[model samples]
Target: MLVDIRVQEEGFSLDAELARLAGVGLDVGGIGLFMGLVRGDGGLAALVLEHYPGMTESMIARIVAQAGTRFGLLACTVIHRVGRLPVGAPIVLVLCAAAHRGAALEATEFVIDWLKTQAPFWKREEFPDGQGRWVAARESDEAAAARWGMDGPTES
Candidate 1:
């Protein structure tokens, strides 16, 4: 089981990554993969993902590790983008492998939900209307983070 945590700096290929994530386990019953793309809202031009370097990685590692503890998943990968990224760039990815479909699916969901709030990442939207602002963390994210029973990150 291999877990990759990378910063998507340039163009990335999802298919290629999915291919690489495959591992030994001829009886692999299920694999789950998720890709998040940029969005445009209210004339938003582009977006930037900023995080507290060491803390961000530690949080992610903890989340992935917790998924392992909870579900005994085979493997998982989480890749997040940083710096100036266009609206359509892949911000994050999570791939989970398991002996059965259920664990894989649950772990995938858990990783994404945990990432939204616990990861310490912030997004700034550059509006085409000559304005820029940070997207407030979603209430859903707060709700999801509560499931883990951990104090959320401090807003910047």
Candidate 2:
């Protein structure tokens, strides 16, 4: 299986990523994707994300590995951006390819759900007033992961 995981401050091209996944040549019948964007809700100015370099990548790789094993994925890619990002900017991308549509879709969903609840990424919401606050995990996000038999994030 091909697993590409990256944590960078630069933006990614969806076109390039899709093309790369398709070119893996594994008789893949479907590719599932999820792109998360920074929302501008409630007059939010921007979002700043931070992660613990090598540790963060390792955790994400483990999550991706679990998804591949569970769904028999042919290939998977995860790209997450850090640093301050303007509203409407892409934050994360999860792509999963499989021999069947169901496996590909399910693996994509599983990886994203785990990432939301388990990934060691911290986010701070900045406002136009020059104020920023650390964002906490939402109960809805915990519930979503729980649906997949995963536990909620523990307080650090």
Candidate 3:
């Protein structure tokens, strides 16, 4: 499996990224992709994401490796953006290519779900009223991660 993990402040071009996957020379029958965007709800102005640079990448790398072991993945790419982002801006992207649709889809979901709950990124939402608050983890995210039935790297 070929795993590519990137944590950057610049926005990404989906087409460009997908093209790189196509060039991998693998017989990928299906490609699953998920793009997460900043929501405009709750009078939000923007979201600020901060992370411990080296640690964040390492954590995501482990998640990708786990997905590769669990699924028959031909290639996988994960891109997560940090810094301030406006509403409607893309924040994260996950792509998985596999021999069958099921593996690609499941691996894509697994990577994103794990990243949400396990990645060491802190988020702060800036409101239109000039107030900012740290974002909290939601039970839904934890539940989603738990459904995978695989213990995360830091889980005791």
**Tens digits of per-residue lDDT for model 2, 32-129:** 99999999998999999999888788888888988888899999999999999999999999999999999999999998998987888999999999
| Candidate 1 local lDDT, 25-92, one digit each (tens) | 66556778778888866766789878888988878887888887777777788888888777777778
Query: What shift in Å separates residue 4 of candidate 2 from its native position after superposition?
Result: 0.4
- Prediction 2 TM-score vs. true: 0.94
State each model's C-alpha RMSD to the native: 3.2, 2.5, 1.3
Q: TM-scores of all models?
A: 0.87, 0.94, 0.95
Give the Cα lDDT of each candidate: 0.77, 0.91, 0.91
Candidate 2 at residue 20, lDDT? 94
Q: Scored by Cα lDDT, where does model 3 land?
A: 0.91
Ranking by TM-score: 3, 2, 1
Question: What residue runs in model 2 are displaced by over 4 Å at the alpha carbon?
Answer: 150-156
lDDT for each residue of candidate 3 in 91-115, tens digit (9 for 90 to 100): 9999999888999999999999999
**Candidate 3 TM-score, true structure as reference:** 0.95
The parts of candidate 1 lying over 4 Å away from their true place are 147-156
